[model samples]
Target: MEFKDYYEVLGVSRTATADEIKKAYRRLAHKYHPDVSKERDAEERFKAVSEAYEVLHDAEKRRAYDQFGHDYRAGDEFRPPPGWQWQPHTGAHARSHRGPNPAEGFSQTDFSEFFSSLFGEGGFAGFGERAQQHARGRHSHARHGEDVTRPLEITLEEAFAGGNRALSVDNGSERRTLNVRIPAGIAPGQKIRLAGQGTPGSNGATAGDLYLEVAYRPHPLYQVDGRDLTLELPLAPWEAALGAKVEVPTLGGRVTLAVPAGAQSGQKLRLRGRGLPGKPAGDQFVRLKIVNPPADTPAARELFQKMADTLPFDPRAGLG
Candidate 1:
């Protein structure tokens, strides 16, 4: 195993405040977001950022990392400390002793090898053995299974209205397809719990729940701010100056939006209750983006010359 410096990954000091760490994570996440970023390595970079944040953001994990990582530098060859039962790259040993058991449920595939080494896959060092003991009815304690959490990405449209999805989950032994219902008015970062859908319990105890954390896929035309939606409404310069009603796409359908007279570029107009559906639904803001016509034709050039000769408007006057 190699020591990974999470602080260095986030470009923050070891003594950096929680707020600073959070800001750095958010900025890097946005910069490397796979859907929007043009960078060839955006996806890999984003994953690394996310992994770093996952550890540094947690107080317990951060404390453990700071203590154990004090003597090591990033990328240094690492070995487990005394009494720690971690064997790096020991696949054959892991399979023989800690192999996957159907009742133990599936392993969390989202985390990296570094994270798994630190956290020990799930809650215990040898979960498969414990599960096997429980199956044989030899285990004394009856403990509930550990809860599972997975990321779920949904489109803005799908988020607006409740929908159903078929998902394939690896339940240790096999891949099981399950139908999931997405509740109406679901928000990002919120979890949808599925009862008894996690690891099977030990000694016939009740199973834990599965939580699906909601995330939004990037949209080309709109941006989500909590419940509110923002969209850039492109308009001709003349249309912006002289108010006009234009058709705009919404989650519900296309609707006519009235632009006020003398609307400037970046001016925002609100549509009440037109955003994601909920009680006291969110509003949609349409921001005007005035697009000037190209002076390619003789008639267009003549109009531009006429405006330049007649109008006394100086757009750069504010710069003074």
Candidate 2:
């Protein structure tokens, strides 16, 4: 039979601590587990990993293997030492064999011929039961799948009006399309959870959830602050100097706004409950921007000159 380097199979150092050996075994076992792994050689790898762990994880078996296995490399033709014999009922071996019956639910035939020759077919009775229990425990402690969060960008119009949106999500292995509902007034950074849409769970556990964080796409006419909306309203010079009921655009629709007399540039006018819909909904703020008509025509130049002559107010009066 060929010699097996149990430490090399588990990817651990010869002097590795027990805990390190167990950790390496668990990681490889989980990766190559036949039920969960997609690798073509997963079943073969899993069997190899399990076989390596069985001998290394047991103290007496590990000690005997190390004392004799040091001279032989993996795949080398191996033979037991000249006078060695299988002694399962003697001294230290007798004490270690007191646990569960290894043959009750396990078969030594499943292991390699090398392992059978090294430990005798029936000598590993205790460890076989232990390995079976470990497999059962791994399934009993199955973990829930992890939650995944991603950003979802939408137009301001879509945010203002609640509606359904079709979103395509790719999770490495496959692409899926989902219909998501956007709640009216859903603010940036708020999350929408889709149940059982994230990574799949192990051992029949429930799948995790998918979270979509809300974000607004850039809009041409409005700036968003939470649920509030701000728009720069351009006004003629005459409209600012004298009060006027001007047409204003809001998320809901167009509305009339009463500009106070002598309204200055940058002055803000508020329209309650006109920004986004919700409980005590947000307000729309219209910022005044006075636009002066250009004096390009001869008649427009005369009108501007007349206004400059008649209006004696100095804009720089506040300057020291």
Candidate 3:
């Protein structure tokens, strides 16, 4: 298999500090996240960057890779050093091919054969702080896998009413599709945790968790403010002056809204408890906008003149 130079992959110098490596990884991860990026090779690039960070972010893993990997370059044919032998991080490696609990280990899918050969499957099992213990050859109790978090974008309707989502995520080495449940009334920036779905632990340690942060897509007609929903309510001149019941849209369904007499543009009407779901559900605010008929025809012009004459009101009094 071809060797992978993780530091080069992250665009960092081999001598870069851990903090620098972390900054580089975060910058690349944000730029290449498949869901948000429009770049042609976003998925592939994202996977490579994630794999690089997985190895380099850990002190022990970085040490081992750097110490043993210096002689190689990216894409160079790689073979283990002479006298090298696979040492089991967990006794389970002796029991069977199962080696270690799959959930506790880092994902090896989509990894270069080079990485797989070096770390093997159990390499990332003790990925958390306990991984440092493994480097010292100390026998530690069960360790939890490191948690993973990613952004998830949803529509307004989906945010209003929780729904089952089918999503694909980078499960360490490869992209894996999953059926995720979105909680109702979920707001942007709120995270949903999927237990035991992250990096696996060594030996019999518990697997880490995965977190999905909620983000809402831009809607054509509505803007969200926390749990509250805001929309422009267009009204005819007569409806604003004489009052009328008009149908407005909500996630649940259409609601008939009563337009009070003398309603004006920019006036806000509140529909209580009609927004996103929560302990005390949010309200929906409708800003009224009165639209006048265009005087394109003779009759329309005549009617407008008649109204101008009949209801004499100075709109610019305040401005004056």
Kindly give the number of clashing pairs for every candidate: 0, 0, 6
Best-to-worst lDDT order: 2, 3, 1
lDDT of 1 by residue, 23-121 (tens): 888888888877779999987777777777766776545645554554455798886665544222233322312111111322345556776787564
> What is the total number of backbone clashes in candidate 2?
0
Over 4 Å off, model 2: 1-143
**Model 3 per-residue lDDT at 119:** 69
- Cα lDDT for residue 5, candidate 2: 81
TM-scores for all predictions: 0.55, 0.55, 0.55
lDDT per residue (tens digit) for residues 12-77 in model 3: 755467788888888887787777899999877877887787778765456556544544557887
Per-residue error (Å), model 1, residue 244: 0.4
Residue pairs of candidate 2 with colliding backbone atoms: none
**Model 1 stretches astray by more than 4 angstroms:** 1-141
Task: Point to the candidate with the largest lDDT.
Answer: 2
Q: Residue 12 lDDT in model 3?
A: 71
The all-Cα superposition gives candidate 2 an RMSD in Å to the true structure of: 23.2
Q: Which model is ahead, 2 or 3, in terms of lDDT?
A: 2
**After best superposition, candidate 3 residue 149: deviation in angstroms?**
0.8
